[model samples]
Target: MANPTNFPDLQVPGGRMHDDQELCEHLLRSLDRPALLEILPSKIDLGGTGLFAKEVIPEGTEVFRSIPLLNCIGHEMSEFMCDYCHTSLTNGIDAAGHLRIAGDALPTISRCTQCGVCSYCSKDCQRKAWRKYHKLECPVLGQHPHASAEARALYRLIAMVKQDSLSEQEWRALAYLKAHEEQWSGHLEDLMYYQPQVDNPHRSTPLAFAVAARSAVRGAETLMQPGIDNLQLYGLYFRILTNDMDVAGPLHPNIGRTVDLVGSLMNHSCDPNTFAFFEGRQLRVRSLKPIQAGEEITVSYVDAREGFMMRHDVLWFKYFIDCKCNRCEEEELRISTLMSQESSSFEDFYQAEKELIDIRNEVSRDYKAFRSEDGINQVKTAISTVVSQIFRTQPWPDTLLPMCHMKQILAELSFKLNTNPNQIAIYTLQSCFGITQRSGPHWVYALHSLATHLTPMTAALNRLKNTPPLLLLLALIMRLLAPPAPPATPPDCPATPRQFWDFYNGLLYELVLQSRKTYGTDSACAVALVEKYARARARSSWLGPEERPLPGERGFAERFGEAQVAMLG
Candidate 1:
């Protein structure tokens, strides 16, 4: 059998190299490699069995860091009050020391010493708002009393502008308002009631309020902030409130809020390649395996069990786009009724529900067995079985299985593996593909299964490329199969052993090709890997003209040749 190519050696301090097959062995030897502090110029390479980083990332190398763009103090309350102090308001307020009525009666108001919008009872609170941005916005409060919720939210934002980093537009808007105090003094009766009968019936209340606020700032071009395109800013702001209000519930008081834009961009994939988590105000994105550059970053928004139709509905609602990704395609193929049938009776859906419940029960039993006996292998086998059963009974078998139950299983496995890090490999597969860290281990295991098994199935699916379902499955399989490679190898470490190189390259090649077929070469993952492969081939002294193939040219025969040879030998 041809020896596998050498895996690249990473430059991280205290790091060592091992063969690809010895990944289990190396993992057993060392648990945690080192903490990543910063993103390196070169991406990390994961094709090899062993993990490696290019430079010696210190113990606290910040792998990811981001400050909150928008922060809310008390967002969780059923109703939003003043943006500054967060006090509940009885009714909206007007400039003439009079309160505005919500329905018929006047609503309560909080008064700010520096600015009326601050709405704080105490002088100290007034002082804080003044320092933030209220000094600029105080004079203009009377201009737009019935602004939209989003517009009012924008006003609170202006009042909080303590930083000098205000864009030119924002400063001008502020300055313009200060100059034209007389223009905003009168109680414009037209402003008392909203314009009746608009196109968007649902938007009347909020839109009316927003239009009033915009009217107040209309002439004050100077006050507009730079890069503060009102529409986009307003859109982002609204998106944040819609998604995060529940999570930032009133009980947990926070000064900052985070929105996962990247996570949001990742339209749903039945077999997703990435997972996300929130740390304080920051969103952390991690690859379950080596994620290739340029692939569309994705997250599994729905539970793995949801059949194709159910998953599609939820995804369409949240993302507002039709999902044509790989997993969706597979579900279409495996379950003929998945896309066409709408459940008319609860009993009609009951059979599918029963299958899921049975699978869940069996998984739980397997988890208990693994826990009681400390049998890692047994646990792995049981997990594999449970996963297979779940897949077979899935509402959309073509897509990846639902993640909820799998997440549960993976969590238990993680707990068991806490004492044995070598078991990390088993978990690592799932971690790379199954569930976000928030979902835990069962999802991770399922991810592993998808990445390992389903990804390869794309080749078979390609024959049916014209079919929408097959095309979608191909796209998903590509993402799960091929992820980004880790950063370059360090100079001091030995070159990646042949055995390791062959294993990693073969797996990566297969994944890359399938991904190309499904997601197209333009996909973020495919493009990233193609670039890396080009660079690697360029740098390699061993590749002669005959040995090298053009990008995406290495067929399965060449890529997986060593693996097959080894098995036969």
Candidate 2:
């Protein structure tokens, strides 16, 4: 069957898929919705499919957005996050609507009466999900309480596919997905050689194929249903490992994973021009830097902070690609200072793991008693000490799991009603890794945190040339994180005068012009700094003209006045 949209299958000049001059026009036309940019499914010089830009796409502009073909929240997080939309249920609420207690059950939570297995924030979410796929999967969810995240995802997809239920493009997309089941058999054979029970046909493979045999069979039933056997479950699991992306939103925690056929068209690169994030269920991709009309659009799939050797190993293992991106070629990464020295003895690794778990549990208990801002430092100190205790054997990078928890706590502590922004910024900076400079989901989050803590009137603006990294960070904060709508700006917050606001605005515009040379005109970093709020009526300025990065640059005196501004217009 051909694509319903008649999106030409990837090919090159002379009807071949190599020696590509330009092949994105056809795929760009195949997009189902209006897009500021188009996708070109063409072959790379490296002998694989690649997505290219069909036009000049500017940075900060929305590239495209795609809804998930199939997605679900992990079973462990089902109670704490919405199963349908993936909204976090972490905000504390009471009958009076003030956050009087910590981690109390949300008022919106509505427990399902029939299955008693899932929770929802509203009946609308419950009804919509039931109509979509939950009716079939609900019957079996109870039987697989300990199922792997991959197993749950497969179950949802298998259950959703019905006769005449999906569109032609949807079916074609599903059919074309890569399933590394052949790779699975090789691993199984090696495991079976040492442990024969692993190959038992009657036994369901734990984690890999955690669903009950009868349950999966019933879910995938239909005369018109595409054939999927028990072993094929492994194929689904493998495809998910390579293709799925976590769904995240502005205010909610990441609650689910999604995949799309066109989304997979883009090839991997460490230094990519494009970056992606979630707007609810839709995956939105945007340019991180400007691209010429014929340029190829790329996005990073792995954590870009790790060493090149570590990155090479992970990419080869999961995505089956060896990155030859510029950063890889330069080999200029800041190696980890995060050392956790330890012996490799089995007993030592085991004991350290136990101590780490105990510490985490203790921290969780103490975290409950103290509300936001109360004893935040105490929690941070205790957590950091525990992280140290667990580090006698494992390298710090290997202990990323615990370190992740520490960073999260520090972030939470930073939001205390009257926490010191400078103090918070210092602590947060110490926890950063090498790749935290430009982008990463967590790094961006930190940037937003730092932005909120900054009082624009502070003396930092005068020293913009001192820390380019911090300047880039502040710009990101202003662009991505808006002033909390409706100004719950704390009572203890400093009165931000007009001249101070003008200084920040003018400084941002100055950064924008500088970024055109360093990053790109379309770079999101520069665009954020000078986009709007920085321009106001001119007034007398401090800091001489010599302080300007550019000779002809405008000053706070030239653009903005001593008038308080609510936001950039």
The ten-residue window of minimal lDDT in model 1 covers 1-10
Give the lDDT of residue 501 in candidate 1: 33
Clashes of each: 75, 7
Q: Write the per-residue lDDT of candidate 2 for residues 1-569, one digit (tens) a residue.
A: 23221222211124322223333443344454333444444444254456666677766555666666776665545677667764445522222323223355554655567555567777888988887777766766656554545556666665565312345455444444554456555654555354544334322233223223224444434321435444554555566656775554432335556666566666678777776655445566766778777787787766554445545655765566678777776652322222313423334433443455455445545654543565676666665565465455443452243344455456555645346654454444444332234443444444444434454324454444232223223332232233333334332333233334444445444444443333334433334433322322222134323233321355434434222222221
Candidate 1, residue 517: CA error in Å?
32
Ten-residue segment with the worst summed lDDT in candidate 2?
4-13
Model 2 score (lDDT): 0.49
Q: Using alpha carbons, what is the TM-score of model 2?
A: 0.59
Q: How much lDDT does each candidate structure score? A: 0.37, 0.49
Error of 1 at 217 (Å): 12
lDDT of 2 at 282: 58
